[model samples]
Target chain A: MPRILRIAGAQMGPNQRADSRPAILARMIALLDQAAEAGAKLVVFPELPFTTFFPRWLIEDQAELDSYFERAMPNPDVQPLFDRAREKGIGFYTGYAELTPEGKRFNSAITVGPDGAILGKYRKVHLPGSVEPRAGDRFQQLEKRYFEYGDLGFPAFRGPAAWHAPVLGMLVCNDRRWPEAWRCYGLQAMELMLIGYNSAAYDPNGGSTENEAIRTFHSTLAAQANAYMNATWAVSVAKAGNEDGSGLIGGSVIVDPNGVIAAEAKTLGDEVIVADADLDLCRQGQTKMFNFAAHRRPEQYRRIVDQVGAQPPGA
Target chain B: MPRILRIAGAQMGPNQRADSRPAILARMIALLDQAAEAGAKLVVFPELPFTTFFPRWLIEDQAELDSYFERAMPNPDVQPLFDRAREKGIGFYTGYAELTPEGKRFNSAITVGPDGAILGKYRKVHLPGSVEPRAGDRFQQLEKRYFEYGDLGFPAFRGPAAWHAPVLGMLVCNDRRWPEAWRCYGLQAMELMLIGYNSAAYDPNGGSTENEAIRTFHSTLAAQANAYMNATWAVSVAKAGNEDGSGLIGGSVIVDPNGVIAAEAKTLGDEVIVADADLDLCRQGQTKMFNFAAHRRPEQYRRIVDQVGAQPPGA
Candidate 1:
């Protein structure tokens, strides 16, 4: 059995802060329909796809920050998109801001089956930015202050049977750049990785030489290499273009186990890129080159678990 | 002060099994002279540069295999190349098979400083190949049968003051593809990474869809992405072209902390690729995006140390 699945990436343009809720949901539903029309069984959407990338600004009011978070998933505001996906018989992986009843917030993502059942959930573990806002900066990255570090570890689960029951994993934005997170899922034999990112066109932290091209290159480089290392198919979608006066990069890609780009987004807009991923293409790497049982030396990897920071050698 | 150190990759052409030791050393000394004339402070050479890739052959004769291993550092057989490097005031990194005093064998490498003093040593940790040879195969990868797994973990050291005394680490061949090996050095705040490889143009193991171009792409991809993720400058050289009737890849590269290629080898023969590596260029990534203290969650990465193989989710 080839175990082939047609997957889609819904790369969206900027969702301005002034954009209404209904307008954003409409765009998402349209993307889902486009993917379904292309015969895609699963579509991946970008992080914080429902609204503007709010972390670029510092929110002073509690109500304003809370408004961006979904107190409960599938709540009335976002039900239409879910209903549309179900009607089209298409599954989706999407990111959002989550708020628990106890009031804790997290940068989160979930995989919903074609029948509108949630298959898996993941919170962003590698959160970038700072808790304290930098003074004298026009745009601030306050992800550290807005959301708590994800407590749900990298977990791998099986997709619905129609999708070959593939072992699936999820990552959001910056989390895709961390190899440790990928390694955890790899140990679980994850066959497909879904990622959603809202990366800045410039250095998210002020005062660096990184530009839109370099940032986009970094995002793509991370996705390709991590996918190759883990021997899995990957779909990394982006929420890109100028959002809320800050520029976000857009180079969404669907990469194979060999790190080759199968299909890529040409513009930072509402685009649907599709690729027929042969899940078995992962076997060559998984069984030979990336055979963890034959190659991995965990005893020599103590530094990865024992330390959290770089500790340079003495003077 | 800008700590700019000019580095060169001494990518060697093939050394046929019938080639003489003096002939191989002469080629290496010529490369050393070329790098020194170009004002390079440090030069990196490929793994087992002194001999043909012996792992490709199944050597049943113990004496023949013993001839390939170096019994002592700076032995009489390889002194002229070291002398030439010292004469030019150039430091270098090179790999060689080792036959220790206790008769243990290992695939190993060393970094020699400008003054002819050894700065650091590392054994290849992720050795790729099987202990048992596949029956009816023309080429055999018997590294597992010939050498023990490297006991010395990834160790980071510093260069001489003339080379800015920058923190440096070494990984031989396949170790470069394993992110865990890089992370160990990254935890030590490694500034520059040196690598040497003799990867095949085709899958050394029989029966796969891989080819020369894809293998070369994989080699470069690993170097670029690992260098970027670890926020270090890297030089990965190759002993390329056909050796002992088997083909080898030659995409040796010099990569910056941003994962951009500074220089790359254009041929499969003797090539010298140079790059002016700014040590300060690593600061931005180390201080921001890759600041392990701020972003890494080791508590959730226990799987990396606790297991060596993939254990897929239950039935």
Candidate 2:
């Protein structure tokens, strides 16, 4: 039998300002149910599942900003999701604005096992957007202002056997664009990477988004690129469409180790897509082609870590 | 003036079984002339441009195998093409099998300036195919039996100003499939990566050629992925079509920093594609978003070097 795992990506539309946390969770659970019907034991949801893209606005009031964060993972409001998942024996991964008891904030993603136990958590290491507000942009990308850089580096996990015991890892939004993010997980030998992104179809500051197609193209390109290069499955979910007049692109997709788009969401709204990811395919990448252990010239790649970032040498 | 360099990719069909070294050089020169007509200052040609991909067969006689290699870069047979290029003030990159004076064999690629000066040379670091003969399949790939691992690592160079003086690097065939190849250039802060690949349309060993589309999709995906991730231009040329009964895939393409296929060749045969590479656009990648120097989490990626290849943790 093929080591196949039916995985689902819950592509979401934008969360409205009036969206209650309960309404969002209900939608998430409905997708989970849909995934189960499609024979998926694991489902992945879009980033910041509970609220509108909070980073789009600059909130001065502390409470208003904190409102976007999930103070605790299994709080009263989200308990239903865990219970429903446990009942179905389904595993899941979700991205949310995280607030610590001491008031520290992070863009975090958590992986939960089939038994409803938290398997592993990953904070967005490659934080994108801006730390400061730029009035010229259609929407402010103030992730830097709102959340501290994630200190918890990329980590991988071997989840419950029900989900095919996938050696999995997670990333949030902008983290997907950085090659290093995928390499870290690849180095950890992650078979499947669950990624949730809240990408603005239009980044006014970049100016390239004048044709929104560029934004979507780039978004999917990152997904396809990492999947092929790392020889791993990447399920990228997007919270797309207009949220309070701010448009975002939606091209949620499942990429095979060969970087082929096995299945993709067509609409910019709430949608669920499922596909059989033959984990055995990764074995080809591991043992035959991209077997990193045998071929990587790590001794030469030392500069990847020693340097702060790529500098145009002698520029 | 836009900091743009009009670059061309000379995508060639397979060197016919009857092709002589002189005949191949003539065809290469014709492509350069065509590129110059398109206002190109630089052109890239596919790997093993002089002869049919020889690794597809096993050779028992040493001198018989050595016949496929160029004893020196400017041997009389190739000097005419270099002279023609210098006359037209066009810089070019080409991949070929190189046999050193000391009889060292390597899958090599070299970059030359408009003035016909050798700018840089790269031996294919990630040689694909097998060393030992496997009788289970139709063709044999004995790259290990033929070439030594490259001692000279990936390096970047700034050539003549006519070619935009963009920090450039080169890789041959199998190296493009490896993410580390691109990352090495990215870490060196290269602005353009010139690559040449002669990939078989079907691998008899991997019994899935029923979907020949998968290999094509993967070839292009690898090109686009590295282009976007490294925030650099990648001009990938292919030697395709049937050579002595073995078929190769040809999808020579020019990918921008945005991972967009700025230009591509449609035919699985000899073709040329050129595009205006806005070197300044790399600034957007360098300064705005993919500023690798600022964002890469290298410290966490130490394992990429510590191990031989990626092994799932606890494997």
Candidate 3:
């Protein structure tokens, strides 16, 4: 299919806990307008765009915790975002904390068509952060404590492009860091992959003394590397800047199949990085240099298939 | 066992067609001397270090074709390298064309202990280039026509260091570009990964018009990405510089578990990139951030095991 998808990675500034959902969605709409003005057919927003990375903090009160979850995607706060996308005839990918009617909390990202209909949804499969709260830690990265592991596997959807729609898939935050997470979309032969991340400068490992820039470097590196390896166009957006005193690394990026960063956002504020990505160009790498069909030796690799050695020494 | 091996990636310039095995071995010896002098316990060399990139040309004569493969590892010409390494109490990794007594041919790399004993061997699995020569091309890459697919799947070696030896695995040339190739080593939880390559500046896909620097970028990108994702130390050495009439890209690099380039070769000629890698640091990414044992999702990933969607739309 002949496809040229002009896409944008909309990096959002920090969302303070005091900021209402309307305030965040209004900023998303502004970014959407900028992306549309830049001739972007689709724009991808950061993970939990409506919240200030709520999982970074540990809350004891149940009422305060429930306040972080989105009861429905198009609740009054987000309907305007859908309205703006429809008006501009632009598709978008956005992430948020989803709480089901039964009160099951899951980290989710969804793709919306230009007509404001949901195309597909993916949960954050490779969730980061420990469940136990470390006393001395700068931030409580108790993601596992706040939300459950995403039940949804990486799923691809037919896109909202004008014609010759590109295949699309969704990944969130830490999922972008794992090569295994991107492999599923690669297997589906996805043309464009969207990932939303909330990367903090806080090093849970106590390894990095460098500023938030370390996460920015790693975030862009993984995005470009996965795109090049899989022969797919990947867009990574982030909730960057300091939020509630926690500093975040904000380097949202768009990478082509050659591992080249085509367009990248420089600032730690509301920004839109746009580039016209010819999905057709992704074919050369696939057909010539990296023909997975001809080159991949799946049968020989029993380790990944069997999960052999994917265990600790005594376990 | 406490273990730390000071290693070097001994990058070499291409061997001209007129160059003798003695000439190539002499250069390798010089590089090894520099490595040993620099306190390196192990050194790694490029694929087919003793010969020019022979697959770039097509030879119809059987005698002329057979001349490219080495009859034995420690045969007269390369024995000097072994003798020097043993004398210096240093181990090394080197790649070469192997011809079995039964007339089998394979592109292989072997790990040698300080005592000049073969610790382990691996044959190149992901053979690149094509059998049918594409005429009017700058350089022909018909490796599939010359060498057989490596029989040895990426194997792990347990020795070549002091007590508490680190696990080692080998990859040759084009094999470094494939994620599938690196996964096997990562699955084995290899402490250190060795790769030797002969990368030509020529582009086969007719896509890149840029110089050899592009290949250098790709080589380093893949190396760092694989190491970071798998939490292993990866060293890539190359046969660089203009060889014969064709130019090769050289940027030998060593990347740590954090996907940071610890050391890199500056020139396209014979150069040694040395680094002292602390083996223990690799554990944090494995045990904390990456934690493959705790984080890998094998159950949902049926495509890899069943090879589903691996093939193109049709056979």
Candidate 4:
């Protein structure tokens, strides 16, 4: 029998503002226990899994802001959740707002080993929203005001498991809209892509109604493209529910190497979606039918770097 | 002074069944004349520029099909268009339905040099729609029945004027949706990418009204990503108008090396969009902001080739 990696997309409900760290930890521990019980080798949580997507509101005070962003990964309060996952022998992906030591901040994700050691860290690359307050009817998405641009580039690392297979990547909510994130990871030949998101129900521009199915389909389409193009398994999880009157749609999915949806969560609750994926499938897709490298021609793409406008200040 | 390529986007209108090759060729020649008048080095036309987007409707008769697909590129009829472009000292990119000698049919694009020589040919890689008939309300796009999947992989070629400077590459309509097309060409250092498309009005599946602007945005976004990621200039032209009552959206655009829309056509007629692109800008972008080659990790991508499925029979 071919060795299979049993991965789970842990789709959790909203982490309300009133929810404390211990309460969230208990909930996360329960999820890990459930995933472990279901024999999942890995479980992926959504972006800002511990709290609400706080960047939706604007903030000016420094003290109140520090409360939202974490100073360290395993700081005393969140240590138990890591310890529980290690105890459960299940690796996981979690997203958070990181307040760096250098006084800069970033929206980031962390992949932790079954032993609770940090496997890899990825900062969100494509930051959306305005840096300063805007004069518009659109809901204030202060991501740019809250977080600095990512300093950590695309980097994949080996996960701690019996197989010791390399599963390289990351994706925050909005990063899925951009192809560069997947391209960067695909160029790295990332076997497993972990993306977590907290997408709002209302389109700030008021384009389409908050259709949950469409959002889910959109997520699946992106996953399908990434899987087919890069020959990697893309697992995306979401935090869904009415968080302080704002709805976050949830349709967590696990896409196989062939761009097929192997398993997906149905309800908006704490659910673990598991699927057995053969690592060899990704290798097969890349080298055979969709062999991008073998048929690639880089010479014609030399114009991609040609600058159209004057270079920005400081080179 | 650095060498620059002045390319023109020949945004064409509808080409109905009753519309003869002479009529279409006349429009193309006019566009070439306009491009030449604008001092453009090359002009690009849309996919299957001579016929209605036939794949939108299913057809099975072999004899009826033979009338639509072209047996040759400059087959007596299209020769005049080429002759006119050559006479005007301008290169051109045009899409056509090809019937190969081996009995295989393909939706292909050809790059014609100023001297009327065929510079390069590309068969579209991504074949959209079903192979067999589907029982549904959706407008069945039967491309698989009409044209075989492309065998000629993405290949970039050196144009007449620039041998070592920039390699030119081609992609057809649906191929724009896939990043592999850009990446494949990017790897070869393709300096200029010419993509031609003819998108229909209906969503085929009857989901939502086809957003031509969004589709156009996708093209520009793809061009921008490819340009920023690979440091290449991409010019995408389209054939717009209701052909036999099927409305086609036209948003032809010329994107420079830094992913900026340099010039664009507003009308869905025989419009000529010209823009000057510098080759040195590509080198600068690659060496600076979008330096994927220098910072990219290939070691992790070893699994990309190791995972292909078994080759299809008779390979």
Best by DockQ: 1
lDDT of 3 by residue, B1-315 (tens): 446678899999879999988888899999999999999988999988989989988778989888888899888778999999999988899998899999888989998999999998988888888888987776788888888888888787676337257878799988887776787777777778999998877664464544576667888999998888888898999899888788788989999987899999999889999998888768877777677766666665666656634332112
Ranking by TM-score: 1, 2, 3, 4
Task: Write one digit per residue (lDDT tens) for candidate 4, span A153-189.
Answer: 6676766546347555887877764455675666666
DockQ of 1: 0.89
Tens digit of lDDT per residue, candidate 2, span B173-275? 8888877778888877788999999888876456663345777778888888788878899899999888888889888899998888999999987788999
Best prediction by TM-score: 1
Give the per-residue lDDT of model 1 (tens digit) for B90-162.
9999999999999999999999999999999999889898999889899988888888999999889999999
Every candidate's TM-score, chain A alone: 0.98, 0.96, 0.94, 0.91
Question: How much is the lDDT of residue B294 in candidate 3?
Answer: 65
Listed per prediction, chain B TM-scores read: 0.98, 0.96, 0.94, 0.91
Q: What is the TM-score of each predicted model, taking all chains together? A: 0.99, 0.95, 0.94, 0.58
Model 1 chain B lDDT-worst window of ten: B202-211
Q: Which portions of model 3 miss their true places by more than 4 Å?
A: A135-138, A161-163, A204-211, A308-315, B1-4, B135-138, B161-164, B204-210, B308-315
Rank order (by lDDT, best first): 1, 2, 3, 4
Which residue pairs come into collision in candidate 3?
none
> lDDT value for candidate 4?
0.74
Worst 10 residues of 3 chain A by lDDT: A306-315
- Candidate 4 Cα errors over 4 Å, as ranges: A136-138, A204-211, A302-315, B1-73, B77-170, B173-177, B180-315
DockQ scores of the candidates: 0.89, 0.66, 0.47, 0.06
